[model samples]
Target chain A: MEYLLHIAILVSIYAMLGLSLDLIVGYAGLLSITHAAFYGIGAYGTALLMINQGFGFFTAMLLGMVISGVVALVIGAVLSRFRGDYYALGSFGFNVIIFSILLNWQSLTRGPLGIPGIHRPELFGISFSDNVMFLILCIILGAIVYGVCWYLTRSSFGRVLTAIREDENMVQVFGYATPYFKLVVFVIAAMLAALAGALLASYITFIDPSSFSLNESIFILAIIILGGLASHEGALAGAFFLIVLPEALRFLGFPSDVAAQMRQVTYGAILVLFMLYRPQGFLGKFRMN
Target chain B: MDILVQILLNAVIAGAIYTLIALGFTLMYSTAKFFDLGYGALIAVGGYATYWSYKQIDLPVWLAIGIGVATAGLLAFLVERFIYRKLRERKASGTILLIASLGVLTIIQAVIAIIFSSQFQTLSKNIGSTRTFNIAGGVITDVQALIFISGLVIMTGVGIVLSRTLFGKAVRAVADDSTVASIVGINSPRILGIVAAVGGAIGGLSGIAVGFDTGIEPLMGMSLLLKGVIAAIIGGIGSIYGAVLGAFLLALIENLGAWQFAGEWKDAIAFAVLIAFLLFRPKGILSK
Candidate 1:
């Protein structure tokens, strides 16, 4: 039961990641792979603030969102200048840069040593210290993230983002400032990613730079790609599938040494197969062009 | 003066490695018109293949190198014939191809790790017995000097072929416009397959050299790929000469930055240069 609860928490955290990345990649048509950096920023921001400033969980989360948003604004500005393949490359570069900072800035982050004993959230004197309680908190937060994405996709702003994805020049010709729309969605997505990061930091009770490297970013990307682009339900399904599939493999009695590589092989094969046969993904309305 | 010469020498050595990588990368990119991230994995393929042949099978070094390079080239050719050719037939976009290539990279790297157990391995029989050459108060190992000479030779050979040979012209035609090249009776797909094989061979050579110089690890391809990509972009993506120039410039900047700051800052500095180039000069230094 405890193991099940741990998996649930992880699923929820990754579900949030998939939903947020979908907004940028699926809706906005920007193949941005920098989600993990924002996720890291949120984790590091909340962790540092809570541990050093004695801020409450909610307060730290809010500040982390702000920090992520500001950083996203700067990054989005630069990323806006690029389209398609360069956009992906530029975003990839940012992910590496942020990861380098996280790994090297040993003073604040403790670098490889990582930050430990992160506090769980407290609301109105109710502590989410236990696994079940933390699961509840995660579900609630995950639902909020899902709700936000749903609302955005239904709005006119969301339509513009979709339009930009389909045809940015056509949308611009229709009097929409495409760059601003892209920037706005990118920022929003970064903040949402940050929220997931905060929850992860609190839930894991430890945070490290290694957790947010380019590989993590790629994993988040694979989640969305597997789920279905531009489909919120797809993101959730993807999160569940990717997170659970590896765990299921663990029960197959493979040697521990080859288990991790086997998991990677599975993911790599899936990505290739999907691109070849099912680029639209399981639930995605938008096919990755 | 000695320190300066040492830094310069280090830059040249690094430049040689980056040049080989960029050359292969640019050659493929010019034809495929997508970042074949799987090309990066071929580096490790070469290194590990060579290691297996030399250490495990106890083959001669020359034979091992031949097998290593051939394996990478043959693998790349097969990948083109089987996967990328199909994707191109479907008219998949560059982004899709890039992601598909990423998948290939992941699979290849993971497979290598699983087979090799992810432990760092050295190709050289006697690691400490390497002869060192002192040039202008700077030291370079025999392998590093070989790396430089090989890079130069490959660069010259490739430059001559592209400029002087009919096959090179066909590749240039395909790069400029694949439809037109096909219409003009050139076999674009065949050209692309050959290019992939040649590029993979060059990448394999660099990997084997790196294995000899430092060591071989499964994950070593990624950073090298990034540096090569940066070099290609900095020099002008499709221009062969530009890749050489960009590689040297990148190596110089990286070494100088490492000299001024901590060695750990090398990647950051290299990436900073990449970002700067991407922002200010997207077409690169050579493109008009």
Candidate 2:
């Protein structure tokens, strides 16, 4: 039961990531590989605040969102100038830069040693210290993220985003500032990814640079890809499936040493197979042109 | 003065490797119109193939290197034929191709890790006894000299071929406009396949150079590929000359930045240069 709870919590955390990434990559038509950079920003920001400044979880998380939003605005402005492969490459550069900061800025992030003993969120007479309580908090936060995404995708803004995805020139001809739209969606997605990072930091009670590398960004991307791009529910389902996959592999009785590599191979195969076979994914409405 | 010379020499050596990588990368991008991240994987495949033949199978060093480069070229040719060709036939978006390449990268890196156990091993066994030469108070190893010579030779050879040969003209046509090239009787698909093979071979050579200079590991390609990509961007994405120029400039800046700050910040410096180029000069220094 406890094991199941742990996995559920992980799924919820990653689901937030999947949903957030879906907004930019799916709805906004921007293929970003820098989600983990924002995720790392949130994790590090929140961790430092809690560990050093003695700020509560909520305060740190909100501040983390603001910081990520500001950074995203800058990065998004630059990335908006690029299209297709350049956009992805530019975003990838950001992820690597941020990761380098996390790994090298020893005075701030403690470098590779990582921050430990992070306290879970505590509310009005409600401590989320217990696993079950934490699970509830994760679900509630996950649902709110889902709801926000749902509203955005269904709104006029979302329609514009989708239109921009399909044909940015046409959307611009229709008199919408496509760059602003792209920038705004990119910022929102970064903030949500930060939220997930904050939740993860508080829940795991530890955070490190290794957890937020380019590989993590790719993993987040794999989640949305597997879940089906542009679909919030697909993100959720994808997160659930991926988070549980390692455990499923564990049960298969493979050598522990090779299990991780096998998982990577599976992810790689998924990306290739999906692109070749099901570009729209299971529940995605959008397909790459 | 001596320290400065050594740093300059180091930058040049590093530039040699980046030149190879960036050259191959730009070549493929010119033809394929997408970032084939799988090209990064071919680096490791080359190094490991050489390692397996030289160490495991006890082949001669030259034979091993040949096998390594050939293996990478074959694998790249196959990938182009089996995977990228299908996508191109369907007119898949560059974004989709990029994601698929990411998948290819992940799969190759993992497979290498699973097979090689992610250990850092050197290609050259005679590390201590290897011959070295001093130029202007800076030292150069035999392998490093070879890397530099190979880069220059390959660059000149590729330039000549592209400018002088019929096949190169076909490649240039395909790069300029595959649709028009196809209409003009140029087999764009075959040209792309050849480009992939050639690019993969160059990338393999760089990996082998690195393996000899430092060591080999599965994850080594990512950082190297990033630097190559940055160099390619700096020089002008589709221009071979620009790729070479960019590689040397990038290496110099990286070494200088490392000298100014710390060695670990080398990757950050390269990326900062990339972001700057993307913003100020997205088309790069030389665009043909």
Candidate 3:
């Protein structure tokens, strides 16, 4: 039961990440691979505030979101100038830069030693120290993000994002500043990613640079691709499936050494197979070109 | 003055390795028009093949090198034939290809790790046995000199192949416009296959050289690939000579920058240079 609950908590956190990324990659048609950087920013932000400043989880989370947003604003502005593959490359560079800072900024980040003993959230006299309580908090936050994403995608602004994704020039020709739209969605996605990061930090009670590397970003990307691009249900389903699939594989009884490597191989095979045959994904509204 | 010479020599050796990788990378990018992340895996494939043959099977060094290069080339050909070709036929976009390449890279790296136990392996029989030569004020080991010589030889060979041969003409025609080239009966797919094979061979050779220099690790491919990509992009993507130039320039900058700071800063400096180039001159130094 406890193990199941732990998986549930992780699924909720990843669901948030998948949903946030869906906004940028699915709706806005921008492939920003630096989503993990924002997630890390939030995780580190919340961890640092709680440990150093003695702040509550809610406050630290909010602050983390703001910090991620500010950084996204700067990066998004520069990145919005690029289109298609260049956009992916630019974001890829940003992720590397952020990761390097996280690893190298030893004075502040404590480097590879990682920030340990991160405190659990205490909100409105309710301590979320228990696993069950933390799981509830994560679900609530995930739902909130999902709701925001659902509403945003259905709005007129959401139409413009899809328009930009399909044809940026057409959107610009119709009098919308496409870059501004891209920047707005990018910032929103960063904040939501940060929220998920905050939850992860609190739950794990530890954070490290390894968790936010380029591979992590690619793993999150795999989640969205496997789930379905541009579909909210797809994001949820993808997160649940990817998270649960690995756990299910664990029960297959392969040697421990080979199992982990096999899991990665499976993931790679699935990604390649999907991209080749089912570019539209299981529940996706749009097909990745 | 001695330190300066040492740094310069180190920079040149680094530049040679980068040139080989970047040349292959640029060749593929020009033809395929996508970032082939799978190329990273081929680097590891080359090194591991050499190690398996030389260490495990006890093959001669030359035979091991030939087997390693052949393995990489054949794997690249198979990938292009089976995976990338099918995708290209479907008119898959660059982004899709990139993602597919990432998947291929992941699969290959994982397979390598599973087989090799993720432990760093050395190809050199004895590091201390290598003879060191003093060129001007800088010292270079035999392996480093071999790498430098190979880099120059491969660059000249590729340059001649691309410029003076009918095959090169076909490759250039395909790169300029695959559709038009195919319409004119150049057989673009065939040219692309040959390019992938050639690129993979060079990439494999680079992997072996790097293994001899430091060691081979499953995860080292990504960093090496990134440096090569950076060189290709900075020198101008799709331009062979430009990539070679960029490789040397990048090597010089990274080495000089590392001289002033901690060694860990080397990668950061390389990336910073890449970002700067991307921001200021996206076309790179020599625009094709």
Candidate 4:
């Protein structure tokens, strides 16, 4: 049961990641690989504050989100000038550059040794020690995240994002200021990613560069794609499906090494196949309208 | 002066590998107008293939290299014919295509890890035992010289093929406009497959060089591909000889940066150059 709770917490984290990505990718039509970079920044930000400055949970999270948001703001400012593949490349370059910093900045990031002993969340004189308690806390956060997604996608701002996705030049011609809208969506999405990262680090009590590699970024993108692009339900569904589906594969009697490879292959194959066969995704609308 | 000469020589060899990979990128970008992130994985395929062919089967080392390049090219061709072709047939968006390449990269890397266990391997068993020559106060290892010569010869050959051959004319025509080329019955799909195969082979050679030049790992492709893309971009993406020049310049800059600072700053220097280019001259140095 505790094992299941652990998986649930992870699923909740991924749900947040997927939802965050859907805003930028699905709604805003930006394909960025830097979401993981923001996530890493958030994780490391919280770790540093707590470990170095002795910050509590709420304060650290707020600071971490701000840090990630600021970084995203700068990155989004320069990169939003590009569209489509250029944006992806720019974001990818940014991700790698951030990754390089995290790897080589031994003095600050501790390099590959990683930070350990991060404590769980403490609120109102109560600490989240039990797996069930943590899961509840995470689920609440996830729900709040979903509500935000719901509200944003339902607003005129979200309509701007959708129009930008379909045709940025057209939106600009209408004096919609597409870049500003894109920057806003990007930073908001980045904060959500960081929020998930902070929760994940607190829950696991450890943080490493490995957790925020390009592969992790792709996996989050895959969750959004697999669940259905631009659909709130798909984000949650993808989180649940990909997280639990692999565990089911564990029972299929495959060798451990092969099983690992299969998981990687499945993630790729599912995304590619689904995109080709059904670009709208499992639960996505045929049209954004 | 001796340190300068040696560093220059080392940079030249590094530039050779970068040029090879960047050529692959430049060709695809020019012809297809999309980035094939999977090219890096193809390079890994070539490196591993060369290792397996020579080390396991006891094939001649050079012949093994040929097989590795051909196999990688063939793999790229198949992917173009199958997945990429299908996607292109559907008139899929560029975003979708890019994501698909990432998928290919993921699956191929997994296959490699499953087979090789993520262990770092070197293609050259006698790299350390190779002969060295000192000329004019600069010492050049046999492998280093080999890399430099092979890079030049292959680059020249590519230049000839692009100018003299009818196939080259078709490739250039397709690059200009795929629709017009297809109207002329140029077999766009087949041409794309062949072009992608050639790119993959070049990419494979680049990987093999690095595997022998340094060491090989499944994840090395990520960084190597970045350097290659940077070179292509710096040289004005899609230019034939521009990528070569860009590679040398990037290598020289990185080596000089390392010499001035520490080795860890090499990547930062490379990316800093990229950012500078993106900010100042988004079109690149060789932007034609």
Error of 3 at A70 (Å): 2.8
Over the true interface, candidate 4 deviates by an RMSD, in Å, of: 2.6
Compute the DockQ of candidate 1. Answer: 0.65
Clashing pairs in model 4, backbone N/Cα/C closer than 3 A: none
Residue B279's lDDT within candidate 2 is 86
Q: What TM-score, over all chains together, does every model reach? A: 0.96, 0.95, 0.95, 0.96
For candidate 3, lDDT tens digit of each residue in A1-289?
A: 9999999999999999999999999998887778899999999999999999999889999999999999999888889988988788778767777887898889899998999999999978999999999999998898899999999999999999999989989888899998899999999999999999999999999999978976677778888898899999999998999888987667988778678777778778877988899987789888766
What proportion of the real contacts between chains A and B does each prediction keep?
A: 0.60, 0.77, 0.55, 0.51
What docking tier does model 3 reach?
medium
Ten contiguous residues with the weakest lDDT in model 4 chain A? A280-289
Which residue segments of model 1 deviate by more than 4 Å?
A52-54
Query: Which pairs of residues collide in candidate 2?
Result: none
Per-residue lDDT of A173 in model 1? 92
Candidate 4 CAPRI classification by DockQ: medium
What C-alpha lDDT values do all the predictions have? 0.92, 0.91, 0.91, 0.87
lDDT of 1 at A26: 93
lDDT (10s digit) by residue, model 2, range A24-107: 999888889889999999999998998899999999999998999999998889898787888899887788789888989898
Number of backbone clashes in candidate 4: 0
Positional deviation of B152 in candidate 4, in angstroms? 1.0
As for candidate 1, its clashing pairs are none
For residues A14-132, what per-residue lDDT tens digits would candidate 4 score against the true structure?
Answer: 99999998999889888887788998998999988988999998799889999999999998888888887878988887887788888888899898888999999899988787888
